[model samples]
Target: MGFPRWSRLGSDLRRAPGRVRARVTTARGRGGPSRRRSRTSHADPPRGGSCRPGRVGSRPHLRRHPRGHRGGHLLSTARSGDSGGECPLHRAAGARDISRCATSPPRHREAGGVRSLVRQPSRAFVSVRRFIAFGVAIVVIFSTLTARLYDLEIVRGDYYHQLSEQNRIVRLPVPAERGGIVDRNGYVLARNIPGFAISVIPVDLSRTREDELSQRLAALLDLPSDAIGDVIRAQRIRNPYEPVRISKTPVPREIALVVTERAELFPGVRVDPESIRFYVDGTLYAPVIGYTGPITEQELAKLKDSGYLPDDDVGRTGIEDVYEQFLRGTYGWREIERDAAQREIKTLALQRATVGNTVSLTIDDRLQKLLDAELRKGVDEDKFTQAVGVAINPQNGEILAMVSIPGYDNNMFARGISTAELAALNADDRHPLVNKAIGDRYPAGSTFKMVTGLSALSAGTATRDTVVNVSASSFSVSGTTFYDWRAHGSLDFVHGFAHSSDIYFYTLAAGTPFAPNVHGVGPDAIAKYARMLGFGAPTGIDLPGEDGGIMPDPQWKIATFDEPWTIGNTYQEAIGQGFVAVTPLQLLNAYASVANGGTLWQPHLLKQVTDAAGKTLPIPQWTSQKLDMTQENLRLIREAARRVVTIGHAYMPNLKIPIAGKTGTAEFGASAGKDSAGRNKLGFHNWFVSFVPQADNTDPTAQIAMAIFTYDSSKSLCELCLNPAVGMTQRILEQYLGPNK
Candidate 1:
């Protein structure tokens, strides 16, 4: 058999309910709860005038049609003599009809018998039957319905009561204001401004006036006409009464326009107060301080479980992100009573918001501004991509100045920038958002030698008098050659470091036939020493995103590149190349350690914290650890660093303050050998790192230690205050330690 068509089967099932009822009733007991024979089947209305069950007025006409001639219609014509004009109704039912008419009892004769009965039985019997049937139906239905009602009202009362309560009361999320951000001196960095957002109470609006209301709102809010329609359409899919934002964070002009002209057209439109971010000082501390914007979708998802909302502003970078918890105050809310239409009637309960605490940094505004001015001057003269400058007090490891060039105005984020402005900022090649002092890592150049000299001395690798001959400026190891800026004939550690003799350090690193372990003392030793001086890790400064510069080892080489560490790699790194890298801040810290007599102090950028009431809060002070070094070894390294500034090396002169320093001309890209003047046009990192007034009987401690890292892609030294040891040292001593103090 062919597969059954479900459409035809469905129709047949719908039409056959009478048969179904008869079958089901017989299968069950008729004596118990007699089921009503409800007509479930539906069929198309019969052709012409068929006797439908509805009206008794049309029944006589239907009865006459079966009697043929009485209605001039044929019932059956098979036995009729006239084939063409024969009446089928007459042939099929005329005889039976005549017999029924002849033998059937008359209604009048029955009525006549009814009158002879005592007490008028006809009227009494009819009334009695109807009354008994009606009473039985009423009792059965009422009893069944009453029992069901009892079950629902009492047994399942708690379950239904909770459901009803949920339907009546809606728990809404209250938007909390974000905390304010401030500088060390209580200057505001980021803040909230009260603003308004337009919303729609969709269910309150009439469907007939929806189009007109949408158009009027579009004009008032400066929104696309379709936007209003879309909001209404979306609400229709969810709860129509729930409030949905039409224009989030609408401008003041937009809000005013709506209130003025289109007030009557927008019954559902309302202004909701919101917060906007602000930044007072624009480019002064842009990179170090960072900015804040709207929370992104991806960030929102990550913070959704933490109870963040769509409008909440979070820290995007720098200290804003670093101390987000402390900088972002707690959010508060209110319990409000709302009408049936979800319009807030009044606030039943309110909670005052707590603002975030202000942060005080070790950075001095005066010193920072001066440092920025100096860096800007350097950048303009050199025409470099970027520049950074850092100054610190060696006695306490306090960062006095930190400056980065090519700063940006944070005010762009204050007013909630459009998509185009944000894209332009991010797309700039100069990377205005970058914090160069801590974020960028460059080779510390020759300045890193102080760490090598100190670490090797402490590690028993090389001594102050460990002499190595240098016939030429360049040195060779394992057939690979490395060269210095100038040649130095026969020199000790002091002379070698003062002249930056690459061959001298290379010879000690290559390990002469005299000392087998001496050659093991190449870049690996330098890197080890570098880490010991806090070169390869964060200086523990209270800044965000401090790049721990790379210091490669044998394990690092194998893990990162699946290659063996080579002697040439070590030799290149010994000269602060190959895989060696360090931030300017790290270089300064290393020299400061040597200046403070082998003490490694953690660089601190925060001096103290306080409450709004002016009560001082307990905070950790600066601390340091001393390296185990003999006084003789420290004296040798100290003299070597000091001579670089005072003695005639690279035509640089000694300072009036008797400062000890080193000038490193590291060949980085293609121009490492040239001076800071950019004459070679390749890239070389010029470094001058030093300490003041070598420790002695008169002044056992150096007051300040400073390092200058200036990169010249053009290879011109004149633009960088070439050999700035004398000038930089004089300026620092004059400001901090001179008679002006």
Candidate 2:
């Protein structure tokens, strides 16, 4: 039943151990013809490379072409188009090579020479090759996708997660309540009161409804729609979720209610509670308490990192400006979740706000009121139009009471002053905002003589018994004549100062032309003592806008006036006349130093700070300097000051409490009229520098040192005798010391 199988066939179909291929043919059954077959013909080749008689199993099998290419030798393929032959297929009809056709060796050209043939590729070979290639491509694609997925999910997950959360969450700032200010006796100077504010959330408004909402808000709030739109647009660029306050100033309560109650009309509108400042007795304490206003663009740039919001209020001037860091409380926040429509859904977190600290000042409200009333009355009753009154505890420099006449109401600024109102304030000739107690400068007048007298005594120029003869109303030196306010026959140092004699102090500093024994120390000695006594500099009060007054020396005069020093200039400097200036506070502080027995204190108003937690914090101590001169010399000066109150030109010896002081009439400009001598008469700036309870005047016994200044009381009707400061100071002492009423 079996011939040898194809697998069992020998190496070359076993026709004597070598290949014996069959013949090849074309589809038209032509074989070994004279003409070559066309390249495109369907050719038949024997798959069993050789055929044997009567059996197919003994034939060697054909191997499929690995690359699936066609057109090779005729013995290469398995296509069956048996048109020609070489080896015989089978002699019997029952053979795998069914046709009993004759075949031959690998076909040769019987007519034409041997030619090339196209062998068709087998289907199995092409299919298996394509399958392997497709499998490799699929594996590479899947591997790349998997590696990218790993990097994205594991390497940078947190950064992307934060971005997603930021889109979903919106944060809003909750304003902290600003601090309060009170005087020493706990009377409120500046405190926060409840007010209303309007705000908009850009994220809550749909883009189509944005303009309509702005128009609605503008109509309700009585503001321009363009302004509201501008604000919303700006906020959208910054952060769409954060609320933008409509205006820095407070809105009306009725309007805020409309926005709240009619929520359907105003989509993103909110009514927020605002803190507004309430200044007690605004005008009376304007210079000390100051005022608050909206944070400016320049200030915002500097304060942005310090947690200041765009609509925040900041102190504008005075004490409010100085203590801003302590007064500005820390901010808080309330974060809530929102839905797709941007409506609040639930609370996520809450942080409560801190209230600002309470500041306690050294000022006494009662004494301030008393000084204010008296100073105003005296100035209004007389020709004087401007004045300053400041009282302090000489030992510690705690300001007791201070009043600058012609002061503006700080409440005007607190409530938001209009452009016209601010312009009016700036335009006022009398300068209502000047705070003359510390801001304005004036000549020292006779008050500076204390420095001169003390300097001469200290520098070996004179003693308590030193006297200079006064033969006339004027003194002449080197052909330059200087006139005194009045003349006396002969005066010692104490009486010279008590009488406020110009020639006596002048000859003490510039020396007598005829007397060789009396040596003069000149302007250097005067300037040294002036600087020694807290003159020519600011008293360093806690108030803003303090002016350091000028003290002229030979060098100072040359620098200021571009002129050389003169002996006459030295004589005038000795009288506190030629080139000297001092603020009311500086003069008060200096006299206070002398009254307290030669100790200068740094002037201040802040006494302590109380935080929100009910804890009191320590305040800085005012710097103090004890005098370099002997205590005995200070006592001698104090006796002269006492004698001025008793027997000097002011001659006001009975005011209830024992007083010692100097009275001054500083020459400023020429009067409108001329004197009897046809010269332009000088105008007098009256000043009263004094203190109370003379007990050799130690710190505890000398309760207060005060300076009263009135500008130009020298109309023909009110000369030096009618100096308004003298009456004002007298009235203040009487009311303060008399019955406690």
Candidate 3:
């Protein structure tokens, strides 16, 4: 397009600086309407200006200014706009000041262009920086994670792997068969019987399903549901994989079949074959054989390392306990792989168990049964509260038959006794559990007269023919009157023992005015003989809980009763009273010593121990020691014992074999004098200690010694009338000796 006259004039003004300068100077000097209009036209748009499409090329009308001031003014105006305005270059360039366009320096204009260029950056550079920063952060985070992964997956891998494997693997125990207990005659005393046992696997059931499983088991086993739940819950806490036994006693065949057939109905339940303890003739041999039960917490603490688990059955008493190590076999185990639900996947390894050894006792079953029968008969007939009978081979100290009446069946303990049943057995006044033959202690009564007589002779206080004048029925000692059961005019030492004369023994033990020439043997000699005869000490039998009878001396009396020894005590002790006491076994063994020519044998019960393969094990030999007494004195006592059985009380009037024995009526309880009803209420513990074949008999090997002790809580009976112990003894002798030969 052709340039207009005004455009040409603007161009000519820009090119002709003198004419433009003269015009700007005239406008400034006048300060008139034209200069005010020029100032208003170049002023900045309202702070923030918006661009218009039609006004793109529009410019404010220019006011002329002097060329010298134009550069300075343009520079100041651009800087002020740039300081606070959003678009400083746009605002300053769009002003209608022609002087700025004509006079702004090239360097200042270049600076404005540079500021506009810096306000915005290219898209590519921004994207590249962000990518670099994000990459660095990702590297840092991943590096830390890799280190932790290395520690967990490589360095400590084996330790964590072991813990994980434990959850998947389980150990199942294979119990070994316990040994059998047999008597000397090859008769079994205790043995094992195979039975079915029900068990629960806790890990296989959920909490809500446990009650359903428990209910099913209770109905099948005839047990309390709560009891089943309790057992299962307890096993869950200990180890969910291990099975807890519900019952081991023999279950009904029908029940077993039902459980086996309906196995799917009872989840986590199992029926397996197991062994239960059985005692043959349990009641007859309970005292000797004892019983077995589950191992207790205290026993588990001691036996855990020894392969005993909490569910193991252990011997509780008698021979079973004494030989536990020999009877309890070695247990075995199998390592099994299991799923999370405790289902067995496969067996990894197995260890076979060894069977326990066999225990053989010295007891003869035939003789034991006979003794038991006779003792039971006597106890029932005499109304005795307790009774005991013991038989031993005097030659070797081997116990033949030991019987304690009112015995119980040991199978109750083996098959799991109820709390109430156990309480009743324990609450019984007569202790049926005790082996009374060796356990009960009683006053020796006249049975100990042999000790005093033998002591007097050994101390050189009297001879077989030495006489004591017993004209008076009673004697005085230290102002205490002592009486004999009856008065004998006179008696020698041999007759004194045979007659059981209290005064003769009293005069021999304490001093006598009628026999002043012969001194008494005194309490010292008596106690010495009592000890030499195995009193005041255990018999060292291979049994538990043996009671050693008391043999008192001055020192023992002072220590026990805190009292000085008086002459009356000596007088009473001379006839087996006062402080003298003896177990039936001890009394029998003592008499056996005399019968066997003064050799006291150490009693034992175990005859041998053999392995399951029938190989015998070496055991300690039987021990015996000779008594410190002359054979002559022993012969005299034996002769006196024979006379007592034959002549003293007529205890064995019809016996044919040369039998010798003594009868004792020991006073017990302060009410022995009279009862509340003033009846003759004296209570006596009757005793009969004996040996067959008198001391003079050539056949010493055929001799057998026995002791019988009986006591009743009511009504005293004479030794000659209701001495059932003696009666039982006679029958035993007759049976063993073939009707007394």
Provide the overall lDDT of each model, using Cα atoms, as 2-decimal numbers.
Answer: 0.61, 0.74, 0.73
Clashes of each: 21, 5, 0
Off by over 4 Å in 2: 1-156, 201-229, 236-242, 251-269, 512-517, 670-682, 694-700, 716-718
lDDT of 3 by residue, 363-428 (tens): 888888777888787777767778888888898888887888777889888766756678888998
lDDT of 3 at 153: 85
Candidate 3 displacement at residue 368 in angstroms: 0.4
How big is the positional error of residue 150 in model 2, measured in Å on the Cα after superposition? 8.3
lDDT of 1 by residue, 403-428 (tens): 67666777666454556677887898
Clashes of 2: 5
TM-score for each prediction?
0.68, 0.74, 0.77
| CA lDDT, candidate 3, residue 229 | 95
- Please give the lDDT score at residue 544 for candidate 1: 78
Model 2 alpha-carbon miss at residue 338, Å:
2.5
**RMSD value for candidate 2:** 11.2
Number of clashes in model 1?
A: 21
